[model samples]
Target chain A: MSPVLRAFLIISALLLLAPLLFPSVYYYRIGVLVLINTLSVTGMVVLLGYVGLVSLGHAGFFAIGAYATAVLPAYGIPPILTILVGAIGAALVAAFIGKPILRLKGHYLAIATLGFGMLVWMVLSKEAWLTGGPDGMVVESIDVKAPFELLGIKIKTAIAWYWICAVAVVIGIVLATNLANSPAGRAMRAVHESDVAAASLGIDVARTKLTAFIISAVYASVAGSLLALFNRYVTPDTADFLHSIEIMTMTVLGGASSVYGALIGALILTSLPQMLTVFAEYENMMFGAIMILTMVLMRQGLAPAIAQLFSRGRK
Target chain B: MSEFVQFCFSGLTVGAIYASVALGFTLIYNASGVINFSQGEFVVIGGMTTAVLIASGVPIWLAAPIAIIAAVIAGMTLYKLAIEPARGAPLVTLIIITIGASIFLRGLMQTVFDKQIHRYEGFSGEQSIAIFGAALLPQSIWILGGSLVVFVLLVWFLSRTKAGNAIRATSSDILAAKLAGINTNSTMMLAFALSAATGALAGVLATPVTFTSYDAGVLMALKGFAAMMLGGVGSPAGALIGGILIGLIEAFTAGYISSDYKDAAAFLVIFLVLFFMPGGLFGMVRVERV
Candidate 1:
């Protein structure tokens, strides 16, 4: 099977199997979070992993998704439709803002995105009339629990959300995997390696980057929407610069270039705090230390390196 | 007019802090092209350590230098352990590493010193002085004085000292500087140490006003970065000047516009500057080399 097909199969297998092996339903709920983060970071892989662009502020997209759902209920849109609106809003804003800013590379791009993220954060925190302000806003829960009840087996809200998130993750992975294999992905690689070479190949370097950014924004938005619905609440932290950096960290720590890398990265990061709760207060320290070490030791990220080690062992 | 004077003092005080932080950022960027995002952590570490020490019965004067010394060590450790190993990695990797280092430092500090807001008595007492009809805290004067002293000392060292010339040479062209028998690695260590010390000094001075916490590093880093960019990358003078400009803008925006939008003004200025003048205010745009 092709890499894309292989990736899809692998994702499906894990999503379907993880629920069965869970010690309790809480693991699945946490797994749902990992899956959601996996979707977000996979989106970032298109920008940071493939194109070699670094955005310090993708939480803007996340917040947009969150707020779209939060704000749209007054308009009487169902929770389901609100997600689509959020994704589209994120994409449009990304494309519009990205058109001007994407031309700059390195630190300049990073700062621009940082500003954009901060701008969104400041707005969300200050605009009490619209956002419910810094107090945080609640969303109308997506009513997906009805389906499990009809099947005559009651599933925990976490489990149902986990399945929903898992499906979303699979779709995001499939889309990103296909994009990475297409000519466009090649063009992105070309740009990433050398913009001059990419331009020489008749690729619109600017446009390619903008496209990646928009798509990545969509992924983040969807993840944000899912997170808001999952928790039934949203805060400006959803789009804070630090949160943006954390997402990018997930993308890099998991292996920026691989779809499965995103999954592994998300899973490790999401589960790390819970696992390392023995030193609960020091969890962030551990998270930070692991991130730095990962960059220093395994630039390819944890998943790919482990895979490499195992594959070598098999050989 | 009184409001303007007060704003200027406030601007100058905050600007001095920004300048110090920005200068620290410039030093690391000058040594190794990586803009260590953890530069702000140096400030946090300094302020937090000082707070801890003072609370533990150390004099504010002694605790301040000790905090700075600790920051220096943290900077060198970050370089030797995390940064040097990742030399020649893509800029993105470098960025992530620094960011990770910063996050790690923040986490470590929180563990070491619990997450609590900290404040200390100002160096020159809590009295406000009348300057041009505006009542200003004496700490503001110390902030202004400290900033000037640091910048002047830095200039003198760079222009008049052998080590300073070695640093300048290395920054202008690393390979040529190496060919000239300069130990670039030691210079890098020196750069990190110096920047960390400056950051610590700023933290020591400003903690009275701003308070200190592990999370404070994020905004401090962003403001310092905006200052650095405004002053042009790799220029200490630019960092200082850019920092003051940013502070003044913040003060003015808070005075005239929504106080909540003060952060927004600094970012907006940075965006506009980078968009229009990529070389920054003092940085020369290098002819593109493909």
Candidate 2:
């Protein structure tokens, strides 16, 4: 079997069998969160890991997805259709803004994206008539059990969300892995190495970057939509700068260049807080220390560093 | 007209604070091509220290200098611990490190002090000076005057002092300055200290009017960054002009447009300006050799 297929099977088996260890419904909720984060971080892997482009505004797209699910259902739109609408809307916004903003390099690009994210956040918080302001709004949940009921298998709501998110995450991973090995992916890597060199090599550097940006935005949007549907509510904090930073930190901590690394990052960050409630006051300090230590000591991130260590031990 | 004048006065008052913060950014960016994300944390340190000290019955005169010194120490520690270890790291790495430093400092402040918002009495008392039907706080004048004085001192130091000349030489060309016996590392540390001092001073002056918490640094950093970008990245005059322009734009937007979207207006202006002039108003257009 191909490495991609083998990896997929292993991940699928883990997802399928892991529920046996769940003692209660709370763990399932955390499981759904991890899957949602994994889906988002997979997109980050493609953009930051493959293309070497950093976007600090991806939470803006996430908010767009969440708000779409929350607000669109009130306008007679179907709950299922809201996810697509949010993804498409986020893609459009990314493409529209990425053209010019992507032209900036380094710190300038980071700041421009930061500004864009703040704009989205401000609008979401201030537009009380449309968004219900900072108080947020209720999200209409999608009916996931109807199909399962036909098969005579009834599941709890949290478990239903976990399975749904798991399927989505698996599909997302497969698609992302396929893209990572495609010709366009090679072009993206080329641009990552040197855009000038990539351009000289006849690659459409701008188009490639825009493709990655749009894809990542769509991923964030879908994950956000899933989160809103699962929780039955949405808020502007989903698009805040801190959320953006959290996403970036997860991506970097897990190993930006590896798909599995992104999954590991998502799982640890999502579940660690639940396990470490005693250290709640020290959360920010610990988070800061982790970011600094990871950057300073292991620039390649956790997965790659561990892999290297294992290989060296084998040698 | 009175309303307009009132807005202008408030604008200048806030603009002066932004200017000092921008100047801090300028110092660090020039010395070491790293945009210090923790610049606003220095401001918080200054304001928080002063507030805590004054509440404990220390005179304002004794408290202010101590706060500045505390911020300076924090700045140097950040450079020594986080930045120096990651020397020659990529821009993204540096950005993450500084952001980490800021988060750490914020957490430390939260632990060391309470999360409550803090402010002390203004230096010149609470008298409101009426100008054109608008009541201006006396502290506003202090903030403006303090920033002006800092700016003048900074310019004089950069041009007239030996250490400042070393810093300039190192910023221009590290290898050339090293060949000429300038210690680049010490110069960078000096830059960080000076930047922190500038930000702390702004925090001290503006806190009476603005009131600050442990979390106030992030917004200040973003606005200061916006101001720096609007004027141009590396230029001091650009920092000053950019900050004031942003403040005026924000004030007018809040006055005429929806107050809720004042920040949005500032960012929109930045986007438009970047589109027209990629290098900013006063920034020189960079040419990549590769």
**Tens digit per residue, CA lDDT, model 2, B1-290:** 98999889888998999999999999999999899988999999999999999999999999999999999999999999889999988777898888778878888889899899999999999989998899899999999899888888888888899988988898888999999999999999999999999999999999999899998887788788888888898888888988888889889999998788887766776677678887777898776556
Worst 10 residues of 2 chain A by lDDT: A278-287
Q: How does each model score on lDDT?
A: 0.87, 0.88
DockQ for every model, please.
0.65, 0.63
- How many residue pairs clash in all the candidates, one count each? 0, 0
TM-score of chain A of 1: 0.96
Judged by DockQ cut-offs, is candidate 1 incorrect, acceptable, medium or high? medium
lDDT score of residue A239 within candidate 1: 87
Worst 10 residues of 2 chain B by lDDT: B265-274
Clashing pairs in 2: none
